[model samples]
Target: METCGSMSPYWVKLNASNCFIGIINNVDCPENTTGLESSTVNLQLTAFAFMITQIPFSVVFGLALQDTENTFLLLCGGCSILVFLLFPISGILAFAGCMLILRDYPDLERGWSFDLCLASSILILIEIIITLIVTTVMGIRSSKRKSNGKPEESVEGKGSSKDGDTQTQSNSYGHSIMKFAQVAITNGAEAAKNAIGMK
Candidate 1:
C-alpha cells in the first residue's frame, strides 16, 4: 500500500480523478434516493389539483343562484354563498396542508409550485368568461324584447286604453301643441326670410 505522505505525483492525480468520478457516478445513479421526497411532492400536487377543480363548480353555482328569480334565488343564493365562501376557505386549508407537506419534504421540484399557481389563475379566468357569456346573452335577449315593442306594464292599469273623452282630450292637446309649434316655426322662418330680403 502507498504511504499517504510519500505518494507519487501520478498516484495523487489518479486519486483526485477517482474522487471526481465517484461524485459523477453518484449523480448518474438510476435509483434516486429521494423516492419518498418525490412521492410527497406528487401528493401535494394532487391535493392542489383537487382544490382547483372545485373552484369552477363553486363559481358556476354561485352565478346561477344569483341570476335565479326571488324564491329560487333565496335558496340558490344560500347554497351558492355557502359554496363560494367555503371553497376559498377549503382551498386555503389545502394550501396550508401543502405547505406542511412541503416543509416535511424540502426537496420538491419548484415546477409544481408554478403549475398550481397557474391552475388557480385559470380557475379565475374561467369564472370571468362564464360571467361575461351569461351577462351578454341576457343583455341581448332584453334588447331584442325592447326592440320588438313589448312595453313593460306596471302593476297599475296604466297601459289600458282610456275612455273616449280622455282619448279625445289627449288627441286635442297633442294637436294643439303640434299646431302651436308649427305656427311658431313658420313665423320664425318668415321673419328670418323677410330680414334676409327673400320672397
Candidate 2:
C-alpha cells in the first residue's frame, strides 16, 4: 500500500512534467514541423496506465460473472493481489525508467510502457477466463447438490452453533454457496482495496 502512496505523487509529477514539456516543445518547434525533434518528449505515456484504469471495473465484472465458490473466488482474489503488486511496479518502472530507456530508441519509453500494460492485460485476461470457468463449474455443482436429497452442508453446519435440525434446515445448498461466494468476494475485494490503497 505504501507503494501506491509513493507512486501517486510520482504519477502526478510525471504527468505534469510530461504536459509541461510537451507544450514547451510544441510552442518552441519551428512552424513546419515534419518530424519529432530531439527535445520533444514523444516518449511520454500516461496512456499505458489506460488499461490499469479498467481494473477496478473489471473486478466488479468478475464478481458478477465469476463463480462464487471458495476455490474460484480465491482464484479471483489471488489474481487481484497479483495485479496489486504488478500494477505499481509496472507503472513506476514505466514512469521512472524513462530516462534509462532514452539511451536506446527515441520514443522508446512509450513503447516500454505499452509493453508493460500489454503483459499485464494478458495476465488479467487469463485470470478472468479461469474465474469464469471455475464459477460455471461451481454453479453446476451447486445445482447438482441442490437436486440431491442430502445437500453439501456439513462444513457450513459444523461452523454454526445452532441445533442439528435448525442448521440443516437453514443452510440450503443455494444459500450456502451464495453465502460463501459473498464472503469470498468481500474478502478478496478488501484485500485488493487495501493493496491498491483504496481502503
Residue range with the least summed lDDT across 10 consecutive positions in model 2: 5-14
Alpha carbon lDDT at 173, candidate 2: 71
Native-referenced Cα lDDT, model 1: 0.47
Q: Please identify model 2 stretches exceeding 4 Å from their true place.
A: 1-110, 150-199
Top candidate on TM-score is 1
The pairs that clash in candidate 2 are 67-135
Measured against the true structure, the TM-scores of the candidates, in listed sequence, are 0.30, 0.26
> What are the Cα lDDT values of the candidates?
0.47, 0.47
Per-residue lDDT tens digits for candidate 1, residues 1-199, read 1111111111111122221111012222234422223443344345445455456757756576667366766656566566554444433433443454447535533333333443453454466668779999999999998766554543223545455558889999999999999999999999999989964
Clashes of 2: 1
TM-score: model 1 vs. ground truth = 0.30
